[model samples]
Target: MKPVTFRNRTWDVAANLHLPADFDPAQTYAALVCVHPGSSCKGQTAGIYAERLAAEGFVAIAFDASFQGESGGEPRYVEDPATRVEDVRCAVDYLMTLPYVDEARIGVLGVCAGGGYAVNAAMTEHRIRAVGTVVAANIGRLYRSYGAAAMLDNIGKQRTAEARGATPLITTWIPDSVEDRKAAGVEDVDLVEAVDYYRTPRGRNPCAPNRLRFTSLANVLAFDAFHLVEDLLVQPIQIVTGDVPGAFGSMQEGRDLYDRVKGEKDLFVIPGATHYDLYDRPEPVARAVGRLATFYRKHL
Candidate 1:
């Protein structure tokens, strides 16, 4: 894996480019852009998938979104859906400039909320030939489940305060630890697994601080990643989600996305796998990567 950087609007996106062991610069290869989950960095699950996909003979890139990780942006840790979508498009642009990359065979794979952003990007970014998602979580719909009305009101107040010179409010994506979540009476299986994967050594990375600007909720609440997908999303899509149900609702969202997509699509549910299991867990991730390799091979 080679560390790389590319321009995304005004920000610089830090990324890792994974290539096959026998990779030859003279040969063009199908490529994939691996998008990390919200509040996570490219060095985590996204890098894992990129490395695995590279071993499968594809050039894969796992990138840190602008305003997060090592990427350059102001008002750091803001999780704006529009910016995230544009990051994917910019990654595609970077791929197009590579001599060893087949621009016509480029695809995208996103995990967790990144999955939602990928689908949103592919809808209008016809340069992407195929779409793949793992444990897809639509940020807008997911936040709505947590009571959008109250959150929106709070965000409005926070934005007003920040405009008046108050320090920007910051919030962690999940509790500091599983024990903290349990003590707070939040025992959702998916959330627990999320805390485990993101906050602990199990999958934590120095670049992934797991924090977001509280006021950023304004855009997240209004954004709909799947909006107009039925009409604009014509690329072949392969969605993989765990069967385990939780507060995150990614399982149901994946099914909903499957039903709404008008073009050729396939949904694979990994039995006994929870939402976070697809993040770094070996067996489940292997299953997801296997399906994705086949899907991209056929489409891209």
Candidate 2:
């Protein structure tokens, strides 16, 4: 993996780029950007995906978000909706520079929050020819408020708060702990996995900076990855989720999102697979990666 400096809009983001062996500048190859889920960095699952994609002869990159991981931003771990979207755009900007790249064949792969960001990016950016998501958390309606009902009421409140010139109120991101999981009851749909993925060694990386912060809640609530989702369907989409009952029941999210799609799309549900399995398990990741390669081979 080759580490490089990447700029997202005004901010500089640190990213790792991987190219296949026997690569040549004279020949153009497809490119894919791998985005880790929120609270994660370029290592872990994104690293695995990047390596796999590189082996398959596609240029792949995994980057830290603007404020998190190794990237630079103020009030670290303080996330913002606008900047995150800009981060995605910036990633595409970086990919266009490589000698062996085919700009028209660029694609995106996002996991969890990264997945949501990828969806939001493709809807707005025309340069991305194809998009894929794994265990995606595209929850704008639930987050912007407090939960579901609060979001509805909070919209006007958030607007009023902004009008009043008060600092935005951010909710507490779920804690990273096994006990927290037990306390929260690990319901099928609640985003308990936030804590699970961010805290556990199964997904944790010490090199990825930032601890859980409360002040950035406004960004999570306000950022709607699927906003203008219907109008944003300019390219093909492929979503991967589990049929399991836990973690937002991504099965429903994937299905509903698929129904909303007006373009070419595919959805796969891993029987007996859980959300985390698709994140790193060898079999699950391999299956999704194969589908992704095939899909991109056809579309990108």
* Per-prediction CA RMSD (Å): 0.9, 3.7
- TM-scores, all candidates, are 0.98, 0.85
Off by over 4 Å in 1: none
lDDT of 2 by residue, 1-300 (tens): 799888765677998999888778799999998878666789877778888888888899998878787888875776666777788788888888876789999999888777888888888888889998887876454454347555546656765776699765544356557787678676544355556665676677875543644545545776677777888777899998888766455567777778888889899878877777777788988988888888889987
lDDT of 1: 0.93
Number of the predicted model whose lDDT against the real structure is largest: 1
Q: lDDT for model 2, on a 0 to 1 scale? A: 0.77
Name the weakest run of 10 consecutive residues (lDDT summed) in model 1: 178-187
Clashing residue pairs, candidate 2? Answer: 145-151
Misplaced by over 4 Å in model 2 are 142-172, 183-197
Model 1 residue 240 lDDT?
98
lDDT of 1 at 171: 89
